[model samples]
Target: RREWSFTLPAIVHAGTLWLMTLLVASELDWQIALGIIGETGLGRGSWNEIAWGLVPAAMLAAVGAWRTWPVTSHAQAYRGLAGSGLAVYLVLWVVLVNLVSSGDPWPLPYLPLLNPLDVAIGLVLLVLARDLLAYRELRPAVPHLWPIAGAVLFLWLNAILARSLHHYAGLPLDLPAMVQSTLAQATFSIAWTVTGLVLMVAASRLRQRLLWMVAAGLLVVVVVKLFLIDLSGRDTLERIVSFVGVGLLLLLAGYLSPMPPAEDKPTGEDAA
Candidate 1:
């Protein structure tokens, strides 16, 4: 029942998985062959430089998106697969960052981290959130609600990812290390928060459900994350950034989606 548009993403995704597994296997020379560390080019040029690998995946995603414009029974699936493929590529980039630590005692630390469970948990939550938001069948009374869920899931994912990376980096377990962790988490929170705010504004202006689901949902999650988790271990500077950055973003969201002054914006749930 699958067509080319439906199947291309699958092929690309499977190819990517096979390629990554093979690439890592050859790089590590695990089991079949021993001793081949540092061949994979880990800790290579600036992380941004390695992004060239993403271009192909990006093009595929664009194709999927374009394909969706034509009427078809499986149009949504095409977009979902395309979007999912794109997200898979992005998440892989994050996972790859920690695989090549300079200090891990293991001879060649390229295996994806799964022992802690947080890494796996974060990955699941983010993927699920994306799938949920992307599903065209989800017709929430308030379309904006979906993005909130997705964004929150991603915030937790980001927090956990950063925290885990810092922990394994083998920094001395002291105040300095704690500060570094907090700083790293805070930096990600701020960046995601700002991005969410921008999307929220865009969603408001366009009055589009898709935009609200991702953008507005982002703000919801970031605010929750700021209070629930990020507040505890962070230092004064980190707190300032969290509060100032998020506070300003909240103001921006408000500006863009300014509330009904007893009448301006729609009152019912459909307004979203």
Candidate 2:
């Protein structure tokens, strides 16, 4: 026995199928368009590779995150659709960054942050962060690990960029030995301290207590490293600069974006 007609369910399923097909077709169209433009070779160069990869993913992500779909269902298909875009974008980002940073003909310059790939990645992250903040309800619907994963990616990129700079100076590839030097050690500490401060500012702007705690933990690690390792090294311009820079950043963090307020527990009187 049936309490309802099959008509609505049928229409919904049909609509989902239609949308899925449209998305797949659009992906194919992108590849075909790239072929027509004579940039069909994947892995020939960094810019061309990104054109064939990140550009389409970015477009899909922007569309999914921004557009409103009419169909709604218990499975929350719309949320999944949007999450798929984010997932694909992130996966492609990891692949491209590794490829470009390692041995691409167009390696990241001495200033890796200003390189095209990192700049694009940073802009995409900023836009995604803005969208996520604007649509609060979408937060729980998307993958929960993205925030932590993004932070890890940021840290890893900074290390890779630093390594690139070190290699450019014709230094040996021995990481442990490299860190023993004044400049390398200072670079590492400064990068971590700056990263922590940036995260603190972001946490304050986002009103996220968890993010604030994570930033605090990162700062603690930097402090521990400073005391244990940096203090043992001879005083040099690099070391002095690192210490001064960290001090200024700490002051800025305190002034501009203090720790987020702790959550208040409900008391008996409040409950009443």
Number of the top candidate by TM-score? Answer: 2
In the predicted model 1, the residue pairs found to clash are 147-213, 147-217, 148-217
- Give all TM-scores, in the order shown: 0.40, 0.57
Instruction: List, residue by residue over 56-165, the lDDT tens digit for candidate 2.
Output: 44544444444444423322333344444444455556555653443233433445556555555565555555545545566674568566666657755654655465
Tell me the spans in candidate 1 whose CA falls farther than 4 Å from its real position.
1-180, 257-272
**Which residue runs of candidate 2 sit more than 4 Å off their true CA positions?**
1-45, 48-52, 55-86, 95-111, 123-137, 142-146, 149-153, 156-160, 163-181, 201-208, 229-235, 251-260
Scanning candidate 1 in windows of ten residues, the lowest lDDT window is 44-53
Task: Give the worst 10-residue stretch by lDDT in candidate 2.
Answer: 1-10
- Top-lDDT candidate index: 2
In the range 124-207, model 1's lDDT, one tens digit per residue, is: 445444444444464453356654555555644454445454455544424444445656557667777777776666666766
lDDT of each: 0.50, 0.59
For candidate 2, give the lDDT of residue 184.
Answer: 67
